[model samples]
Target: MKMKNIKLIGIGLVGAILMIGCTDLDEELNDSVNEAAGFSASDLLAGAYSSMRELQHEQDILASYVHSSDELIAPTRGADWDDAGAWRDHHLHSWTNTHPHIDKTWRDLNSRAFNAQLVLCNGDASATEIAEATFLRTLSDFFTLDLFGVVPRRACNEDLLQPPTQQLGRAEAIDVFISEMEAVLNDMPTANGPITATQNAGRMLLAKLYLNKAVYKATGQDGVAQPGPYTFDPVDMTMAINHLNEITGYSLEDDYFSSFTPTNTETSTEIIFVSENELGGATGNIRNRWHMTMHYNQQPSGWNGFVATADLYNLFEDGDVRRSTDIPGLTDAFGYNAGFLVGQQQGPSDKTLTSLIDLEDRPGNPLVFTEEVDIFSSNERNGIRVIKYLPNLELSADADGISFSNDDAPGNDYVFFRYADARLMKAEAILRGGTDTNGESALAIINELRTSRNASMLPAVTESDILDERSRELYWEGWRRNDQIRFNTFLGTWQAKADASPERALLMPIPAEALATNPNLTQNSGY
Candidate 1:
């Protein structure tokens, strides 16, 4: 990676002078102090990074992508998590422009893009700084494009007071994202460590963009109410494979749980890009993955929110290590095993944990999570909870006890991109008729991953097999929505979701607020 030498100009000084001239004595004094101590580009970069963290973990954003997918659902459990049916709307594919999560996510991504642009305009930014800022902007833009089917555009030099009217459509957004990523590829650092912005991270993003380009380019489904076949261009798959090959520094972690431990930032060899988080400080909300899923009586008590569908839980073969339900007798530094939590759960002291919230029928029995859920209104302990990201046991208040603070964020860095995803993407590309360069067949890649995860290797792989493999490997990691979309399974009927048209529900409706603010914004066809 090449670093550009750049010098900070007097923009800070000019701004300070303007503030002092326009404000009272206290404001002038504050400006005077700031002018003496020069503005830091590093601070700007940190802000850009924080924006990415917020975008990834915001409640609405997470719900839009994760809850809408088949792998996870925030079902209405007794008196909890109904949120006036907002959470249920996601899985049912009934989300509207007024959906709070949808609106907040759109606003957050747009704000992040603007903030990154401001950082890029800071004359002190080195080539490395510029590349990182560009990456952040592009990432937010990519999300905006992916979720809304349009990318809102605003130049740093443009007037902030004047609302942004310029927008890029799906195909145009894809092109811009790809081009911007390519421009920063050489300047971005390679992933030798846990840095957030890297060349390989950029490559992963590019591969994803290329892999989904065909879906972005699809047409003629406007106003349609059912999901139909969409053509996948071989060129897009080839591009996806080419970009995947460029990311060579990362390898799969032998233990599938290693990539998701509370200390994953320091321990996992698989994480390529992550939202760096800390115990006492703010960065990532990795805790939500646990806090949202676990029962209220569980050690390190959780909100008793989202849970895995029984159908998804049943997909895992018996004895598959990935499906291991072992609850460690004692909570280690790493916490419990990765995967779904069913049957009787134990506390930190290895005692059978009972639910504080009782069910309608089984009120006094131990809180045994069952695979079967009522869908409309489940008992407090009805659904199987997911603990895919190991709970943060190190932060527990006592060795024999587990303590969790609702306000405190987890220490684990949430992985945004990892080696396993790249491997799977490469395999999918090959299966879709992409040319293989490294002499590794699609079956070889799939079997390698499967075997490493303690599952039997398949003799052959099919498209359905690949989709199932993806669900097994990547469930609850926030890729399910995209995977389901690509597999044409987004609109398929599941536990609570009825069969719907992909054209109607695949893309989220543009938030009504966004449309009101920006006249240029147009709602998706069904909305």
Candidate 2:
């Protein structure tokens, strides 16, 4: 067979297998091509991009990280989200090697890395195509290192059936990842109002890796797999700041909610890299952020599984616009609060919502979401629900013009890197004993963000204050686990959690399935 024919066959095989696995079989089946015999290099590159989307949505990876951090929690509401206690295990930091989500995320990310490698191996690809594939592979590798403390390694020519893929530890992996990103930085295109691999995206990724390099290299508290007592190398910190400063032509959105609306891809100026999701298109799972948290009685009902803790809610000052509660009676196009939902709930019709009697531990009153959660006997509506990403509300004219009440899939592009994050990280690096070009202090940087959000300027800043700012700014967008770990706060007691087993709980254990499939893998300490 010709090389193109072989590559096409490989693409078709992978697509068919993935189609069978994705829950929305109808959509995936429709997307799966009958054969890849006539596919071009761009078609293969598009396949790689689609695989990257899978990494974003698969196995609840985003939710797992949010729940594990201080900002959010997945409480078992009677019987709604027990999930074999998997949800609670994250908040409690007690997940085992066999944790289903952990294993699924591992497989999903590695599969993307491998698929990207396959695209590169097909010698017919152009230089641009090669750069794009390398970008995708590096993205997967970055996540693998961030979450698992190890990066799975395989060459483009490696056989799929190989039993053991080599692994690189955190320090080695960071060095290699940085070098790879640097090589492709200039080749990546700048965004032209559409999502694509870009120079800004590359710089943002490199900045993040450099900022966390100290945590990646830290070693202390024997048998504890947590981040520092970090040694923030001045060179790495300078590089992080310099890379962030180089990115231009983006700024913070005036309205905090604008960045997360259904039309965020076009509205948000802060986004540098995003997972492009379209409701009826070939990609986009960003709607899960909304579907997973809102109450069932609300318009576009949600799973009602995840809730923000009082600690996170309390971080917002009384006048802070980020707190959805402060914006009373204001609703988005979706008729839901723009941020956190608390107290009495309202639907699109402006009618008060009441929980069904059959709901576990029903309160028999208006559905009131409290900041406090009992963890044991909390009512079905005890915790404050999040609506950070507005629910999909577009109604088809042919269908009585009623909005989608429960869209399991939404189209808002999920932002992975944004300018605000880069700004915040710059602030953090300065605070952690690094200097800036203009002699800006960490407090000044933080105040700039606060002032933009209409929040009160703080008199002074501390490490704890910076962490709180991070939660307030970046909550539900991911980065909580990493922030917590980097600050040595992951194992601390918070809300309903106790600081038990702080050391070993920092890094997740290598999934049992991964170890079984690859003999070269070893479990993290204190599994």
Candidate 3:
């Protein structure tokens, strides 16, 4: 076993921590060995891209832990178990100690970035791909910084052996990442199409970079400090507008379910940044299928995890189509009717009471009561299961299997970015600036999203309404925690979630193992 050092490049056993954060700090981190091989710049860039994509595997597992509710399931039995709704505790502990996933992604991204620096810094690539690589580097850092908070910003491979230099905390925040990202955007090539076989062509990366600018400032008290070089700046609002305006030609499907259908072509419009999933790939989207949804057929016993919370379910307005799109009232997949009800106690044949859900009811949004309503396990995810990226008909045949490679899953790119996100960002920026910020215009941008849901359009939007809209629109896409934190509402309690969840929960704890490995490092508050 190699020495487990937080600052040193994570390799093999010490890698899983970065996977929790998807920092790419850990992946492809075997620089000691890789460097001696002396690969070409193109080879390095492609390898890095491959490593960056590994997060899909790690993210699928972590996301599973997020949806399990206290009310629905009995406590899980193991320390590394998902029963307590805190499987992340294991991720935090394992971060820098063992598990190569984290180290693999980090090393992969860093290797790519280092390769880009070597080529660009030395004038190797023609400057266009260099711009793309630079954008990737900043993006890789953004993922690391957002999750880990303080990460090494090494510009070259030579820095690998050096002690992990500490980067400033979110408290000393500058829009450095955003600024760096924007500077590269102007120089990089634009997306020729939604799907890219040869080039990176997604709008989500850019949208996400700007989308969080406001939150980044709001978090680090440094933005609001007086007489300091750092101050909250509204310039990001324009960045939000410009980047969003540049992305167009995508629209919502007539039915949200269309996007989730097996062998879906609609995903071309819905997904912006899908990681490539190879056929029979064990560590890919199936993890998502297994972790998030109940596969009574696959498990034999019953669905074991990821029930949505009552509070999260109620966030949807009545008649909003996304409630069904984001989460299903029951368990099971397309053809397994028995195990698909909302509150069934046993398997479909053993079913007793019909599964009923209260979150779907509203003064304005009453249930339409179609046969589509599922009533399976009593724990049929009292909330919705994520429906954003199910397999298309081509791959739908194998959907029930326990493991599938990238090629066997739906071809729809995992939508990391899209127009809907941009529009929401605009709505958020407008609401943040004040009542007159966009005047009637803000409502136009936000309400367009609601129009599809068949919900009432907001003649005017307040910050509260925008927050509600984001919860409705972007629920499982991974922005919930960020939105809650940005608005300073992370610590607040909802009906289902208790007050014990605090603002500190907004930022994750530094993996305990990470601190142990690098004794020089300190844990984040409330760890």
* Model 1 Cα lDDT, one tens digit per residue, 440-497: 7899999999987878899999988998998898888878888888888888788767
Segments in model 3 whose C-alpha atoms lie over 4 Å from true places: 1-37, 58-85, 88-123, 166-168, 171-174, 195-207, 218-232, 257-267, 279-283, 298-303, 325-386, 392-412, 434-440, 516-520
Sliding window of 10 residues with minimal summed lDDT for model 3? 1-10
Better of 1 and 3 by lDDT: 1
Candidate 2's C-alpha runs over 4 A off are 1-39, 219-226, 325-336, 348-363, 398-406
| TM-score order of candidates, top first | 2, 1, 3
Q: Candidate 2, after superposition: displacement of residue 70 in Å?
A: 0.7
Q: Against the hidden true structure, what lDDT does model 1 obtain? A: 0.71
List per-prediction Cα lDDT, in the order shown.
Answer: 0.71, 0.71, 0.44
Error of 1 at 222 (Å): 8.3
Better of 1 and 3 by TM-score: 1
Q: How far out, in Å, is residue 229 in model 2?
A: 1.9
Q: lDDT tens digits, residues 1-527, model 2?
A: 00111233345344323311323334433343334424666777776776666655625557457878888877777777888987778888888999988877777777677667656777788777777778888887777777878777765544434543567787678888889888878877765453676788888888998999888777443323444667788889888888888888888777877777667878888888776666655545666687677777665656777788888898898767788633333363334467777777654442322221222223456777889886545667889888787756655445543446335556677778888898899898887766688677889889999998889999999988898899999987888988988887887888878665457676777787667656677778877
Q: Model 1 clash pairs?
A: 226-501, 227-501, 227-502
Q: TM-score, each model?
A: 0.86, 0.87, 0.69
Tens-digit lDDT track of model 3 for 105-195: 3444434344334434433465565665666566556655565455444334433433345454554433666555556655665553432
